[model samples]
Target: MASKVIKIAVPVVIIVLAVVASSALISMRKPPEKKEEQRQSVLVNAETIQTEDLVYKIRSQGTVKPRLETNLSSEVNGRIVEVADNFIEGGFFNEGDLLVRVEQSDYLTNVKAAQASLANAQAALEEEKARGRVAEEEWRSFTDGTAPELGLRRPQLASALATVRSAEAELERANRDLARTEIRAPYAGLVKSRNANLGQFITRGSSVGTIYGTDVAEIRLPLTDNDAGFIQLPDFANDSVKPDVTLTATVSGEVVQWPAKLVRTEGVLDERSRVIYAVAQVQDPYQRNSPDKTPLRFGRFVQAEILGDATTNVIVVPRYLLLAQQQVLVVDKDSQLQFRPVVLERSDERHAYVRSGFLDGDRLAVSAIANPLAGTVVRVSGDTDEQVADDAASEEATALTSQVKE
Candidate 1:
């Protein structure tokens, strides 16, 4: 009985030992699987910093106006006898071109009457002069006689001379009135509107028409005080300096761009808008004798871009790289995240010019992330180098395209 009991116990103990060894092997394999599961990956995107030319610009909405605009009016009162053939709206005319004509019959009659009056006065003056000569001779003859009763004196001759002068003045006035019957253009311009026509009665100082000089058009753009610095303007006396500015207008679904220049600036600030008014002069290229494309017209709306300071050797980054308005995320050589404060020298909708806190070859994270904390482990992925190169090429292409369009 003792031997049988011992055999059964020994088998049972052997089975238990086998089970324990298998459990130990399984435990050793589970650790490796758990370690693999515990590993974490951080998704991130990056861009490279590069040096290029950057332009600092100020953008504003502006309206086009004629450089020289005039409201033509009738200077003399009369019935309109003739209207200029080119008096229609948008009609171009040269300086001294006849714009309108008043009935000159009445003016001519007045002139003739003035001339007749002047002639009559001249005849009377001649008679008085002949009488004065005789009187002078008689006085000389009576030089020996001391005293004689003389009813009239030399003062009467002076009064007669004054009367002749007045008649001559009236004749000159009539000549001037005759010349004023025809309305002439003071400068070469386009007719904006006509208020008077042939056979229409017009009074002095009445609105007859409006004219705008075709030589140039002006655009007034408002600027903020912050934009006053860093922009270079052309010298006025330098005739060779062409205003290297351009304006774009969208008319009838077609985009048209024209050359322009920074003409002048309003010295005082506008109280209501708190902005400085800057004027840009655009040449009229559409004139009959113009050598290039038609210049911009008066009252046309356009987007104006005034050339500002072109910065060299600056790192221009996507505007989105700025976090919370003033902070940026930079990746170091060790692949660690760093929060850097930067000074934004200039900023636009697409790009930002950073004055400091970054260098060339530094990687900048452009894509926004969730809870970007210091010392957080992350797996930096995405086309950092390739993206930077592509972005630079794209930006250069866009700038070239804009220049060509302009």
Candidate 2:
């Protein structure tokens, strides 16, 4: 009986200790704490804006042409009797080189006739002068005063002078016509075509063929109003130093370039397209000045890039960074994206040249975002513009304070 009572009492004591421990644990626990909610910010890639002395360039396209193309004509009427081997199509000739000769028999006869007439007039004039001298001596013996005009044979002398003048004019014309029988090149050029053949009759002003001068090749490049601003074109009325240009064309699956000069712009704008045409010249296109000089063939289409005027304090950035309405998203000083409007001086395939709008040290945001808004919170990869400005100002202040202390 005593052992049973001790077992029951131990069980009761154990139950009481377990209940007390559970109450103490419950009292030790704390209440749940509330947390603050945070919004996610967009991340973007940005670049720092800087000033550069960049050489602006304008691009254009044009066709190469001869500086002067001539329609060769015969100056006198004659039958073609002789032809030069170099006078055929695609032939080259120097200035004053005879390319064709007409039968000279008829022209020679005319020249001789004119010469005989001139000789006769000269002889008559000499005879009249001799007679006047003799008559004047006789008149002077009778009157000791100025002899009468008729006694000095003045009328006969005047008539002879007139005849001489007429004959001389005829002789000059005859010689000129005879010389014209042989067609000679007026300038160094290549024959583009040949129309006259042996035994063919040709008259004055008759078209014989076509030829082009090879001294310099010209190209007319059309530029819009916008493109005109970038280049410094020479004046046609007053000569100026022409800006250098690079001309390129594709030949044999390779691109070749040549140095050209921007000569002048066609003064008048095109009535149809409203575009101004600028002329470019390439000297000695065929006859190279150097061993590596390649010929810019006539009629080949080519692209031209003219070095243009330079402007100070300009910014350059990638094209993707600029947004619609000439606006740009800039990462401002406060770790936020601010929409900015900028002035675009020009844009090419990959870059945009900025003339105005943003200050120096602007952080330009290049990455695109969804539903972007002004003053949007964003994270950037580089130092922000605000921080740079603050740092610079702080350094300036420190420098001033140092000088004061010294």
Candidate 3:
């Protein structure tokens, strides 16, 4: 009995001592120190707004084409007796240069025959005049009141004169036909194709070749309606200055640029594309006058950038920085984000031109912020470390002063 009681008492004492020690420790322990929650702020990159005058540049593309191209044809019927050395395809010729000559013997014979006919007609006219004079003298010796036209042979003399004029006209026609036997270039240009060769028989109005004028090259550039407003098109009624354009193309495995002028618009919108076409002209595209420049060949694809009208005092920003709804994020003087509704004057693929809604010295956020709200705190990455510290100290002081007033 005594041993049992002692064991039970000892176990009870151990349990009691453990519970008392746990309770004492809990009572002596301090509660966790309360911590004020820190408000979250975003870091973003920004730039200062500074408005300036901007000149717009509009971009377009087109294929180069000759200003003038023609199909050369023969004016007389004959065998091609001679072909000029520069009558083949890709051959260059100057204005009035003979390209091909037909058989001249037949034309020459015709000319001689017509000349002989003219001479015979003149001799007959002279003989008729002499006869008329003899008739008039015979009439005067008889009665000579006024000689009848028939007696004077006036009708015969008139017929002879008409014959002489007809012969003269025929001779002139024969000479012109003889000259047409030789086909000559009408302008300084290059031959695109040649059909007639030596000994080849050809008829009048036969297309013997095709040529392209090298004096000027033209490109038709298409512009959208939005882009058309920014550029100053040529005005036919007014003395408007032609806009300058720079054309770029790849030739001989290298990229090249040529200068051109925006000469005129097509005067109507393209039916299919719903865009306006502007024609640009490049002088001496074959480099005949400007040897140092790369020749802008016909049928080459090129891109053009036209210098457009200028605008004053506009804020230009990268296109990516613009947010939804034509808005942009700008930090206020209190370092809080403010959503600004901007008036976009114009925008390109890479940039946006703002006409209003931003003042000078406004800090525009260039970096993105997800799910931004107006008046949210933000830190500008453009600020120096010292400036950030100064800003933070100033904010803390202001907060303390406000708290004291409250």
Candidate 4:
């Protein structure tokens, strides 16, 4: 019984001593030293915003087309006796160049017949005049108060004059028909298609070929309602300056640009699309007048940039920089991020035009930030030189080590 009590008392005394030791240790220890927390700043790219007189450009796309395209047709019925060497598709011709020739043998015969008939009518008219003079003299020799109409032979003379006039008209018609046998180009252009060929008989008003004028090329650029508001179209009522346009296309794997003028607009908007088409004209599109320039060929797809009216003191920024709710991220002088709500006058695929809500010389944050909050610390582009140098040095060391191993 003594041994049992002693063992239990010894264990209880050990537990009590352990507890007192822990209590003393806790009381004697010093509290941890407090240190101010340091916040890390994000690195971003920024630009100094400046207001300027901005000349905006409206972008649209279209296909190049000829200003004048026509279907050449035959004016007289005949078999094609000859076709010009340059009368096929893609052949170029000048004004008055004969493109096709009909068989002229029949037309020549008709012209000769008409000429002979005219000569005969004229000879008959002279004979009738002489007879009338003789009749008038004989009537005067007989008796004279007033000569009778039959005695004067006036009706016969009138009939002869009418026959001569009729013959003259017939001769003119024959000459015109003979001239129509040779088909000539009405303007300087290139052949788009050819229908009638040599030895082919064509009737009057039958299509001979299709031609396109090379003097001017036109592109119909479609514009939305917003785009139209920025562009100033040519005023037909008053003499106003036409807006300038630049057309770009990729030809033969090379990008090319051509200067054009916004000449006119389609009077009505398209019902289905609710868009208006503006015609831009490129002079000497085939390089006929300007041989040094590249030709803007027909049917080539092109993008057009039209110069719009200039606006004063406008700030333009990249479209991507604009955030939700018409806001933009800007960096303040204290290197803090600020979400500024901007008054966006207009925006396109690539750029946004800001009318107000930003002061000149403000630093605009160009680099993207995820879940950005106001008053977040940031380091601007140039302010991170030391960090970039450290990264570059580390990369160089790694490269040297790899080279040594190799």
Candidate 5:
């Protein structure tokens, strides 16, 4: 009992003495001033929002195709005797250039035969006319003022003239067949393929090969019904000029762009894809009309951007600045963060076009933040509008220079 009491008393006494010692130390020092804890500000980059004339572009992709594709066939039957210098696959030919020549021996014989027949008909007609004149003279000597139709030989003369006309028609037909022996190209184009060869016997209307004109290259870009409304397309009815489009594609690890014009739309909407196809045409795709030698070759897949109506009073924000659920982080005038719901018009690869939700001079937070609250205080890395633009420009220039160097 005594030991238990003594142990408890000793601990109690030590605690009391320690408390008194702490109170004395606290009293000896100057009175400490109480202050609230300071908040650790998050550093972020802010961009000043501005409303400008924004052109809402519609993006689409498609493959390039030739404007005109035709299958060349033979119009006359004969043995192929000659071929053009550029008659092979991937060859080029000018208008009226002879592509293939068939043997003309049989056609020439027909023409000669028809000519001989025509000459015989002409000689026979002359003899018949003389006979009719002699008969008319005999009738005049034997009868009085007029003679009977049989005596004048008028029916025979008419029949002879008809025979001459028939012979002439036959000659013209023979001549046409002879001319078709030499097949000529109707237009300047590139041969996609060729099946005919020298000394190959081909029948009339046989398939030769395929070719396509190089005057223009067309790409069919499919757009959704919502996307089509933003672009102006050419009307097939009234023949209105279409909107301009730009196409970009990667070739040999480099991106190349080509200018094209929206020509026409496919008459009906696609049943499966539910898309409206708009056609874009690139003039002189072989660079025949311009100094730029890059050709927008056929069958190249590319992405197209069609120009649309001008959207006034719209803010352009960087795509990374967009937050969850189409929200944007805007810094208020008090330097506090705000998660604002924006009326997102459209979002492309790089920009989020905001129709409403933002005003001029509102600072938009562009830097990354982790689980940021609405009223969280943040430190601005750069305050001025010009400074932000300068920073962005510097970053872009550095990227371009690095890419060029690489």
Candidate 6:
């Protein structure tokens, strides 16, 4: 019985050992499963490059002022007897309009006195002429043997005529002085302030008022040396060729754009600021009778922008593409990064104009990734060739529709 029990136990043990060995062998042959955290990276899509025209430009800021502004002053001394109806601050007037009048009684009296003096001189000359004529006749009679006696010389009559002429000139001068008592406007403009009041004493060269000519306003904009290179100035006489400039002033938190023109630019650069001054002209649309009331007062703070030279068929890319000031990264057909040196023509917040180092239809990688390698495989996202073709077709269709409508 013992021998039989031993034989069964031995077989059972051998079977268990074989099963364990087979399970261990299977486990060793199978490969390990990858962890969920592990991942393979892929390159993002790059921008499509194309050929286009580029323009270089520079930009700066400046202030707005009146094209013509002046402080009106009194030419003669007197009491301010009369003030113009539009003599107060912010008043409007036309050229040749009466602005102020000094007390004219004194000037008129002087003129009348001068006239009286001229009249008296004329009377005296007539008396002298009568006497001289008598004297001349006597002299002629003596020469002709009719009478013989000393007579007045002819030179005395000539002196009397000259005195009469001098008196006439004085009368004319007095009349002119009377007319100058009333001050008139030199140009059509708006009155900015009044310095003299009615019944106030005034002297020659005294401040009467301030005026600004609003027919055309001016704006001074500063430009860096780099920006001056691209601008093409219009002919002095060609008003229409000037760039359409604009100015904005934040009043009560609202911005208003005023139409302006490029009038001129200072030829020399400012040493202190390293900038060139450019002046622009703008028409004031705010005359008293004008439908618009955008008042362009002198010395008002304003922000200005000049619409500069424009180029057609140019490529405009984001400003971020610049690396190390003047360098850019370009991706070649082999998915390799090329450090290309480029000339930057203009850079605004939104775009940059490159003069070279790029061609039309070239792919550029805008998005960056860690450990980016040259000649690596990349997949395009956001934009694709099929999408581009579709866009082109859609654009063409739109153009056809527009033409048909037209």
Backbone collision count in every prediction?
4, 0, 0, 0, 0, 8
Instruction: Say which candidate scores most in TM-score.
Output: 4
Question: What is the C-alpha lDDT profile of model 3 across 48-161, one tens digit per residue?
Answer: 888889789998999999999999888899999889999888898899999999999988999999999999999999999999999999999999499989999999999999
lDDT of 5 by residue, 103-213 (tens): 999999999999998998898899889999999898888768788787778888888899899999999999999999988888888899998999999999998889889
Every candidate's lDDT: 0.77, 0.86, 0.91, 0.91, 0.87, 0.74
**Which residue pairs collide, candidate 3?**
none
Tens-place lDDT per residue, model 6, 21-45, is: 9999998896889778945335476
How does candidate 3 fare on TM-score?
0.82
lDDT (Cα, 0-100) at 216 in candidate 3? 90
Candidate 6 off by > 4 Å: 1-39, 42-45, 53-60, 125-138, 144-158, 234-241, 248-255, 310-313, 346-350, 359-361, 368-378, 383-406
Clashing pairs in 4: none
Q: What is the overall TM-score of model 5 with all chains considered together? A: 0.76
After superposition on all C-alphas, the RMSD of every candidate to the true structure, in Å, is: 11.4, 11.0, 6.1, 7.1, 9.8, 9.6
As a TM-score, model 1 comes out at 0.76
lDDT, residue 382, model 4: 80
RMSD of 5: 9.8
- The order of the candidates by TM-score, greatest first, is 4, 3, 2, 1, 5, 6
Error of 4 at 401 (Å): 37
Candidate 5 ranges beyond 4 A from true positions: 1-39, 127-155, 237-240, 252-254, 289-292, 320-326, 344-346, 359-361, 383-406
Q: Which parts of model 1 are misplaced by more than 4 Å?
A: 1-35, 38-40, 53-57, 144-154, 233-243, 291-295, 359-361, 377-406
Q: Model 4 clash tally? A: 0
By TM-score, how accurate is candidate 2?
0.77
